[model samples]
Target: MIQLIECPRDAMQGLPEFIDTAIKAAYINQLIEVGFHTIDFGSFVSPKAIPQMRDTAEVLEMLDLHKAKSKLLAIVANVRGAEDALRFEEIDYLGFPLSVSETFQQRNTNASIAQALETVETIQNLCQTKGKEQVVYLSMGFGNPYGDPFSPDLVAEFVQKLDELEVKTISLSDTIGVATPELITEIFQVQITSFPHITFGAHLHSRVEDINEKVLAGLKGGCRRFDGALKGFGGCPMAKDELIGNMATEVMIETFKEEGYSLDLNQMELEEAIKLSNSIFL
Candidate 1:
């Protein structure tokens, strides 16, 4: 069965509406009860850059992880962010984003892709020292707005770069939500075949209509772990203007449930989660 990694925290990064930690915790607890195998809980980056994630630690304290068998992941931008994230035992995956877009690397975190990769060694060392697993989010593996077209060959090369760095899993992210089904299949297939040993996953961004096609694309390409937001929560304010949100979890569930696939997430529990989200963000 394919595993779903719910990412409400990462998705809600630049939300215009601010849902307090308590409300977020309440909403998240509902998700936890429903049962996703993993979750990208929050980022430990500088609050000045993403004010929404400033409550990372507090949210960790508030979430009810014991309700289900799931891993909680957190995005860490640098060594410092990793350090802060390590202090919390609640986090199971330490996501280190490596952008294929050089311009995006600097604009998002004020560091080049090379510089970000440089920090990976240190971050990996820290994760090992602290006994935590690390995940590499391959952001902008799709087309970049800078007129630099993304290619499967380049994607394979970056996966090789990750292999050389001794990174574990590689998460392909459609940072700008510009990915088509054909593009998704081609990219994942090439990388999965070349890096057969590496754990393959996706962090997708698509409208409600694209859910099944995108999911099937990755599944056909041999991807087992997929990411989604509670209520279509994210779009990088730094990546582009007027972007759609992250792939919505409910939409994915509806598609899969009808197809007789499983997520371990129940329909009633899902409705409660969306209701909470609507109340808080709608």
Candidate 2:
């Protein structure tokens, strides 16, 4: 059975317009009914930077988790963002995204790789103190567009830094959709062997054809807890050429279904989710 994670909120990042907060909160309840064990809902960042996520706080307040079978994820770019997220009761998971490529890190978050990890350390400590789960999103874990050479050793070293922070979950992000199946195997081999207890997963940006290859490698590497967006909505605009950022949940379901795996998603419930997503950004 595949434990497919859905990411509706993250999927809308690249959307050009900001939907009404009330409408957003209204749709979130629909997604909660589906069987996705987790949903990366929204991020706490500057409105000017990622306008699509500007309503995060209000959306969290409006979210109805009366049937909270699925965990909630809130992306935080830095210590202050994580600090702001801690003030909310509706959020269940705190995600920290750090790009392995230095140039991309500076472009995306205005922080170098080292500075980002320092922020992660601070955020991780705060999450532990505030009783929140910390997740590391290793952006460009597969490859980067900034001419940085990708390698398993570099990724392993980054994961080692994440381990030191004691984060419970980690995601290898294919930031620019450059990861091939062979590299996926190499990178996964190192991290999974080193951190057996950590719940690691993939946060991909590649097309449908590429997903299976990477997912297969992830499975072979003993990874669990992958993430995907609904209807392929979101991607980081800062990426070169505005690349699509997340793996779509609908596509994810189709792939997992072929293998007879399930995250227990109700087909009718998912259609409702799609409607909710369309109503917001389409």
Candidate 3:
């Protein structure tokens, strides 16, 4: 079965206005009932960096997790954020973005590539000690517009480094929605074939017109995990001003169903969550 990760935090982070903590928790609580494998629910970053998510801990307090089947994953930019997130025993995974592009690395995390790698090693150690897992996102896993050097070989080398650190899960991110379907296939094929032990995920950003092709390409390249947001709502604010939306979760579900892939989702709950999204995003 494919693992669908609902990313409401990613959907909301770049918004200019702040969402109410109660409302954010209500939406995520409903999503938890939809039975996704995981929910990318919130982050532990600085309020200055992402003021929209300043209430993540407050939101977590409101979630009704006693009956929740889905795991919670929070994004952390550095070891400090990771430490903050670790204090919450309810959080199951910590996500760290490690960009292959030097320019993006600094822009997104305020750290160079070397510094980010060291942070990952430190966070991985914390997770191990705290009994939590880490999910590393290869931001700019596709090409970038900053004139940064990029290639399939470069991505493979990063994978090797992370693998040496015993990082088990990595998501290839199309940070600015610049990935072609061909490139998606080629990159995922290389990483999956080369590192059989690691679980590869696709966190693709795209225009509505290109969503189907990109989703299909990831599947064809042997990726079973994917991250999506309702209605394709958000993108990386640090990447650019004109953000490319996330892969729409509903569109992905449609494509997977048409391809004869079975997903373990609660249709009734999904419909309710979609209704709530209409209210929250506007």
Best by TM-score: 3
- Candidates ranked, most accurate by TM-score first: 3, 1, 2
Off by over 4 Å in 1: none
Worst-scoring 10-residue span by lDDT in model 2? 216-225
Clashes of each: 1, 2, 0
Model 3 whole-model lDDT (C-alpha atoms): 0.96
Q: What is the lDDT, from 0 to 100, of the residue 101 in candidate 1?
A: 83
Q: Top lDDT: which candidate number?
A: 3
Q: Which regions in candidate 2 have their CA more than 4 angstroms from the true location?
A: none
Q: Write the residue-wise lDDT of candidate 1 on 58-148 in tens digits.
A: 8889887765677889998999999999998778889988888888888887898889988887888888888898899888888788876
Q: Which residue pairs come into collision in candidate 3?
A: none
Model 3 superposed RMSD (Cα):
0.6
Could you tell me which residue pairs clash in candidate 1?
A: 11-233
Question: On residues 158-185, what C-alpha lDDT tens digit does candidate 3 reach at each position?
Answer: 9999999999999999999999999999
Residue 260 error, candidate 3, Å: 0.9
